[model samples]
Target: MTFKSLLGGAALSFALALPVLAEENPAIEQRQGQFKLYVHNFGVMGGMAQGRMEYDADMAQTAADNLFHLTRHDQSRLWPEGTDSMSVDGTRASPAIWDDLDDFVTKFAALQDAAEGLQAVAGDGLDAMRAGFGPVGQACQACHESYRDEAS
Candidate 1:
C-alpha cells in the first residue's frame, strides 16, 4: 500500500499498454514516445504527492530530473502542422495545438518553470516536494486540457 509500491504497479500496467512499434508517421511516433516518458515520470511525482507512495528523496529527485530533462529538450519536430487527430488516425492531438500555438508555447514555458522548481526541491524533503508538485501538475493539466483528447 506504500506509495512506491502502488506507483510501481501502475507503471507496470502502463508499460504493458505502451506502443510496440513506431507509427508510420514520424510525428505521431515521436510524440507518443515523449508522452510515454512524461507519463512515467509524472506518475512517480504524482504518486508521492497523493500520499500513495513513501517519499524517498532519491526517487523523487530522479523523477523530477527526468521531467526537468524533458522540458529542456527541443520538441518542435514532434508537433508539425497537419499532425493532429483530426488529420491523423493514431494521435489524439487537437488541431487547436497548431491553431493556438502561442498558448501552447506559454503552457510549455510554465511547465519548464515548474520542472525547474521541482528539480530544485525534489531532494530536499517531503515538504519541499509537496510545495513544488502543484504547479507542475497544474501546468500539465493546462496543456492537456487545451491540446489532448481524453483517452477512449
Candidate 2:
C-alpha cells in the first residue's frame, strides 16, 4: 500500500499502454505520446501529494523535473487546425482550442510556471512537495477543463 509500490505498478501499467505505432494523423500520434509521458509523471507527483504513496524525494524530484521539461517544449506543431475531437476520432482535443489559441497558450504558460514551481520544491521535503503540488494540479485542471473533451 506504499506510494512507491503503487507507483511502480502504475508505471508498469502506463508503459504497457504507451502507443508505439503511428496514428492516422502524425500530430495525434505525437501529441498522445507526449501526453502519455505527462500522465505518468503527473501520476507519480499526485500520489505524493495525496499521501496515497510514501514520498520518495528522489522520485518526486525526478517526476517534477520530467513534467517541467515536458511543458517547456513547443507543442504547437502537435495541434493542427483541423484536428479537434469533432474532426479526429482518436483525440480529445476540443474545437475550442482552435477558436481561442491565445487562451490555450496562456494556459500552457500557467502549467509551465506551475511545473517549474513544483520542480523547485519537490525534493525539499514532504511538506514542500505537498505545498507546491497544488498549482500544478490546478493548472492541468484548468486546461483540461477548457480544451479537452470528457468524451474520450
Candidate 3:
C-alpha cells in the first residue's frame, strides 16, 4: 500500500477507537441515584419497622423486599473494565473501589446478606425486623465511606 493510504487507514482506525474508549468510562450517576433511592426507601421502611414512624406492616414489608431485590441486582455495571473513577454529569465515584475491587465486592456481599437477613424476619413483626437493621446500616455506611462521594 502507498504510504499515504496506510497513514489514512491508521488515522481512520484511531478515530473508530474513540467511541470504544469513551464507553470504557460508563456513567455512574444512574447507579448512584438508584442506590440513593434505595437508601431512602430503606429508611422509610426501617423507621416504620422500628416504630420511629407510623407502622404499616404491608408497606414496610414491601419496602424491605424491594431493598433485598435491589441489593441482589447486578452491580458490576457501575464499574467498567480499566475504570477506576466514573463521572456521570457532575457526580463522582472514586476509583479507589476498582483499585480495591475485592473489598468492594466483599462490602456489597455483606450488604446483601444484611438485606436478606432483614427480609427473612420482615413478616414476623417490628421487633424481629429491627434485629437486622444495625448490621445492614453499617454495611451501607462502610461501602459509601470507601467508594462513594462524601456528600452521598
lDDT of each: 0.87, 0.89, 0.73
Instruction: Assess the local accuracy of residue 115 in candidate 3 as a C-alpha lDDT between 0 and 100.
Output: 90
Write the residue-wise lDDT of candidate 1 on 7-107 in tens digits.
Answer: 99999999756542337678779879888998898889888888999999999999999999988889999888777776666788888989989999999
lDDT of 3 by residue, 59-90 (tens): 76777788999888887676665333443223
Full candidate order by lDDT, most accurate first = 2, 1, 3
Segments of candidate 3 deviating more than 4 angstroms: 1-26, 49-52, 81-89
lDDT of 2 by residue, 1-152 (tens): 99999999999999656543236789888989999999999999888788899999999999999999999888989998777887767788899999999999999999999999999999999999988899988998999999999765
- Model 1 global lDDT (CA atoms, 0 to 1): 0.87
**Model 2 misplaced stretches (Cα beyond 4 Å):** 1-22
Ranking by TM-score: 2, 1, 3
Worst 10 residues of 2 by lDDT: 15-24
Please report the candidate that would top lDDT against the real structure: 2
TM-score of each: 0.82, 0.83, 0.72
For every model in order, what is the number of clashing pairs?
3, 2, 1
